[model samples]
Target: MPRWGMVIDLEKCTGCQACTAACQMENCRLPGEMWQDVLFYSEGEYPSGKLTWLPRPCMHCENPSCVAVCPTGAAYKAENGAVLIDWERCIGCKYCMIACPYGVRFYAEEKQKTQPDIRDVFPAKGDKVWDPPYKMPEQVQDPKHGVGVQPKNVVSKCTFCYHRTSKAPTGLKDLDPNDPATRKFTPACVVTCAPGARYFGDLDNPESNVRKLIAEKRGTRLLDQTGNRPQVYYLAGEAPVIPETRSVRKPKQSPET
Candidate 1:
């Protein structure tokens, strides 16, 4: 099987949150809990300040800290290199949340982050934790891999759209959104990215677009110090390089002060 992975061309990203929205809708997540986020921050002080953005999804690390910390074996790495959570096995210990350095994992239960608790408003129907007005493809609803609307008390993160990718023909290298042949099978975030900043493919294939971009552009992963060895790579290009998390820059001090 192909070692599935993703490469993001940061130079092309516009931080429009199309990827974020697409992930929410495709995965049927609650409003406050999105699998993707585009963080914005500034560098330098006023006159010289520059605004930059970084879009973060689950890294799907080869040595996932989340997987390592899950006591119940609820979180496990799939053969294709995806870190997936079996909602049925997950006990909502929140160990994965604390283990993740990227702040990507989310556990939403009785405590609602969004006011009025959408869960209580919509209420769950049958096995589903909450019924979303928008219906997702029935095929994508697999709790075993943490797809579809999450069950109560389970930690959830991105699965690289495994439901689609797993069905792709054997030995396939890349799933490019621009490619008509692979467009339907591409990850929702990758497909909805208006600027075409994202690319998903087999990392093991040297001929794949994702691998080629990583090689030519010297792609980098976030939080390298953690030694998780992320499968996701960022081709920063002309965009600001994200070496570490960006803390919001404070304003410059006046001479009078």
Candidate 2:
């Protein structure tokens, strides 16, 4: 039983939205519905200010507050340590939304539908776009689970692409070690990262890359003060030094004299 986890190196992250896009496309999320996001925080003076880019995802806490507050038991910590939602049981009460400190939980406003009047198109071969038949309302599918339907009203967030990871071919489950096609079990965002800043694996395995990263990089979890024990860890980045500023003195009024 592996406790799946993720490590995000803040030093290597460039604030690119590739991971965000990849997750959305893989998960078939609707427009404006994002499971992961890179939040930017800045402080200090303009010339020499510090900028921090924090990529936030479902923390999958060991003691998830969302699970505690969910009256319908929609949110719960899976055996693998991943926080999961049972859409069928979710009553859209949004109690989990208020309990979540990371702000990862999202309530689907309305079921997504493809308008028949609008011409649909997709990339064909080398062509950028090809006209296709009008598509009707389609539910987001989990490619691995073959479950492509999301209930009308439920809270949703990143599943670490569980459907993809679990169904991966026998030898392809581990991304760090593999041979060609057999090495493609990485989560959608991890696969799409240009800088390879994100690492995923069983945190419990001492030999796993994620565990090694935590030991070597001294990764820290966000909001440790809350005692949520989030599975996601972050490698601290160099803090930008802000130069001290002095008040400028007005020039002597020689012309007035």
Candidate 3:
């Protein structure tokens, strides 16, 4: 079996959220739940300040902590190396969310970070959380692989577009979206990347583009210290860095004079 992997060239990335939009449409994700994200933040003082954008998707770790923590065996690492959550078995525990270093998982039961909930704006016709204004494309509807319109109260994340990738020709090494022949089986986010920054291929194959890029470009993983062994790799002159840890908390107030 081929070990799936992705390589993102930071130099070619323009921080466009095209991948984000395509993922939402392709996967039938909720308005605020982004499977592909471009995280933008500023660095340095006024004169030297600049914005840095990091595109993030599920790392699909070789040793996924999410899989370790799921109470119902919902989160699993597939044979091809994609980490996926089964909507049917998920208990909405959010343990996987807590375990992920990339903050890529979403539990839709919680209120969207953005205000004026879009679910209310466009209500679903049936048991789905909400129906989108646009017609959702037909999907394989395999809840075991989380491939379809999500049900209520389930945690979800990126699946590397499994529904499409699974259908690619057997023994194929790479799934380059730019190739017309392979386009039909390519992931939506990979296909929609405007700058052609993302690449997907069989990491175990020496001839595969992903493996070649990782060798030539000096690919690096985020939070490598955690030992998740992420299959996703980044390439650039200065590889994008993610802090090993983080938390949100209010600052302490000084005692009143």
Candidate 4:
């Protein structure tokens, strides 16, 4: 059984958000409904401050809390270690959303019906090849598998590109440094990374790059204390840490003299 996983090299990642863009286009997620996010913040104070951008995706934990809390079994881990959501079974109770420690889950909102924009309106060409308006492959539209064309009022998250990965031969090990078909099976975010900071493969395979990188780079998991045992590993001097939740406060205005 292949246990898929990812290794993110923080040092090499510039956080340009290419991965986020690729995921959106591949999954057809709406604006602001990013399956992956690049979080940026400053470290230190004053002139010595430094900026860091961290890429975040689903952890696909070995002991996923989302799966544990799901009321209708919408959240489940696949045979290859992908944490998937069966949109058909999802009841929009938000239990898995609350249980996810990584904050990767999202509840899809109902899109308002609207007419095409003036600029987008075009005359009917009568089935022209390479038309301006083309239908992109909708991954979330599969109701049975819940892989593409995400429906409204359902919780959705990353699936490690299950549609692609599930096609890989059982004997296959490394996703990268392998056959073209195997490479095509990896998540879009993994291959789209320009800096090669993201790696995906079977973590259980000794020869896999994911395992090799984690071992050689001293990779670590986030919030391991939570006992979720996330499969995603970070290889860097320090893994990105999510700050404790705090109430937002408005900036104080200067008093008039």
* Global lDDT of each candidate: 0.85, 0.67, 0.83, 0.75
Off by over 4 Å in 2: 110-149, 168-174, 177-183, 240-257
Candidate 1 per-residue C-alpha lDDT over 1-257 given as tens digits, one digit per residue, 9 for 90 to 100 = 88889898888899899999999988888887878988876556557667778899999999999999999999999888889999999999999999988888997765767778887788898766798888577766888988888887788999888888877888789988888988888899999999989999999999998888899999999988899999999998875657575344443542222
Report each candidate's C-alpha RMSD, comma-separated, in the order given: 2.5, 9.6, 4.0, 6.0
Clashing pairs in 1: none
lDDT of 1: 0.85
Between candidates 3 and 4, name the one with more favorable TM-score: 3
Per-prediction backbone clash count: 0, 1, 1, 6
TM-score per candidate, chains pooled: 0.92, 0.75, 0.90, 0.81
The better-scoring model by lDDT among 1 and 2 is: 1
In terms of TM-score, how similar is model 2 to the real structure? 0.75
Give the TM-score comparing model 3 with the true structure, all chains together.
0.90
Question: Which ranking of candidates, highest lDDT first?
Answer: 1, 3, 4, 2
Regarding lDDT, does 2 or 3 come out ahead? 3
